[model samples]
Target: MGFWHTMVEVFPRFMPVLLEGAVIAVEVAAGALVVALAGGLVLALATLAPLRPVRFAARAYIEIIRGTPALTQLFIIYFGLADIGLGLPPLAAAIVGLGGNGAAYLAEVYRAGIAAIHRGQREAALSLGLVPTDVMRYVILPQATRIMVPPFCNFAIQLLLATSLVSAVAAPEIMFRARNLVMETYLSPHVYLLAAMLYLAVSIPMSHLTARLEQRLKRSR
Candidate 1:
């Protein structure tokens, strides 16, 4: 009864602030995803580029990003850039940090997806008199898209969770607000409890979508 009362009393204090924070988190995740998708596609293409330098550059970026911690990357994007006077706002930093980190992994996903398309498909498309662009547009990409969906969904879910790290750089996301509340009230349990619920609320749907896609992939296989 006492625990319930404390929870009820603390709810009003944390819920509103956390709700606002949750919205910011979602916005950051979604915006970062746009960056990842576009940049990842470009990086994947670079891997197949005819020039050795292009391939080397793309490989370097992927390896460096994938090799380092996401939080370290966030600090680089947020603080390191600031030291150079190219200071990005918190939201923008979150986008670039999360997006840049995610792009490395997504690039691998894109590369694998594109590669999974049998070389025969490309050859057949060329034999059909389709130009390279048309071969990619009409044949290769369409097939790769199907193969990519499950893994894409998985990475997106992971990226959504990664948004929590942005709060450390003062992005006003859910964890940021929760941390503030904990400090102010010193009621750690109630505050963190609510934060967990809030994160779970957002994450549950993403988890579901990823699972469904995986199941679909299996059945197709």
Candidate 2:
């Protein structure tokens, strides 16, 4: 039988399964992003803290997480932690691992965004009887948000693609299901190609949206 003919036959059976996996992938990405966003904000704040030790500690975390392979981190969370009686379920491990990894990256993104705001604005807010917390909440973050949005969108796309990595831990995301289907059907090329297409279907639209957002931000400036 021809390859296309084989694909046509398997496509119907394959697509539904893959779509289910894709939903899980989306869920993992969304959960991880929430973790990342919250952790990143805290890390960013820590890095900018007045105390030298706090800043050093935050920077160290960013470096260590940035230095390591995410897959290894996932393994540590899922497999290694199990040996120490701290076992997490596959989906939970994937979310925490990816979220922890992404926190380091988004910390830098957050820090850079916060830094891009002028020193004068912060000083002015301080001079106007605002406390440090109020200054950051009202003056600094509001402006930094405009700078942060574009990069945050880009990171979301990266995190979505990175969800494929969770398959290594048996989280049943897109690539995991694709691998299973390929093994069962022995149609590596067709199965993998469909998986790639599913990713592209989500990612390409996000890329375009990010681009348009950037352009709009530029115009508004």
Candidate 3:
């Protein structure tokens, strides 16, 4: 049978599972994104910290996470943590792992973004009587965030795709459901093809939206 025929034959049975997985996928991505942003910001600030020890620790974490494979991180979170009697749900473990990993990458992005700003901008903000926090909030971060948007959006999409690895820990995300369908129907191409399409559906729009938002921000400035 053709791929379309296979889709028709399989979808009715699989759609429910696929839909559930999609929900899980969105939930995981959104949760991870939030964690990544919060953690990344803290790490970014630490990167500029005055204390040597704090700066060293932050940089070390970023390097370690960026250097390691996310799958290994997931295993450490899911399995290794269980060894210590800190048992988290598989889905929670996946979120923490993915979010923590993404945070490291994003912290570097934030660091670079902040660094790209002209030193004059910081001096000027200080001269204007703004406190350090006020300077970052009003001057430095506002512009740096604009510069960071494109790369950050790309990482967000990567995070979305990375959620697939959660399946290894029994998180029932889209790829996990796809694997189950493939096992039952033995229709690898169609099952995976549909999964890819669904991912593209989400990712493509997000990319475009980010682009449009960047443009709008530029115009407003």
| Backbone clash tally (model 2) | 0
Q: Which candidate is the best by TM-score?
A: 2
Candidate 3 overall Cα lDDT vs. reference? 0.90
Writing each residue's lDDT as its tens digit, candidate 3 over 1-221 gives 58798788877777777878989989999899989998999999998999999999999999999999999999999999899999789889988999999999899899999999999999998998999999998999999998898788888888998999999999999999999989988988888888888888888998898889778877976
Q: After superposition, how far is residue 76 of candidate 3 from its true place, in Å?
A: 0.0
Please give each candidate's TM-score.
0.94, 0.97, 0.92
Model 1: residues with Cα > 4 Å off, grouped in runs: 216-221
lDDT of 2 by residue, 5-86 (tens): 9889989999999999999999999999999999999999999899999999999999999999999999999999999999
User: How much does each candidate deviate from the true structure in C-alpha RMSD?
Assistant: 1.5, 1.0, 1.7
Worst 10 residues of 2 by lDDT: 1-10
Q: Write the per-residue lDDT of candidate 1 for residues 131-209, one digit (tens) a residue.
A: 9888987898888988898888887877878889999789999899999999999988888899999888878988997
Per-residue lDDT, model 1, residue 178, is 91
Superposition TM-score, candidate 2 onto the true structure: 0.97
Model 3 worst lDDT window (10 residues): 10-19
Best by lDDT: 2
lDDT comparing candidate 2 with the true structure: 0.94
TM-score for candidate 1, residues paired by index: 0.94
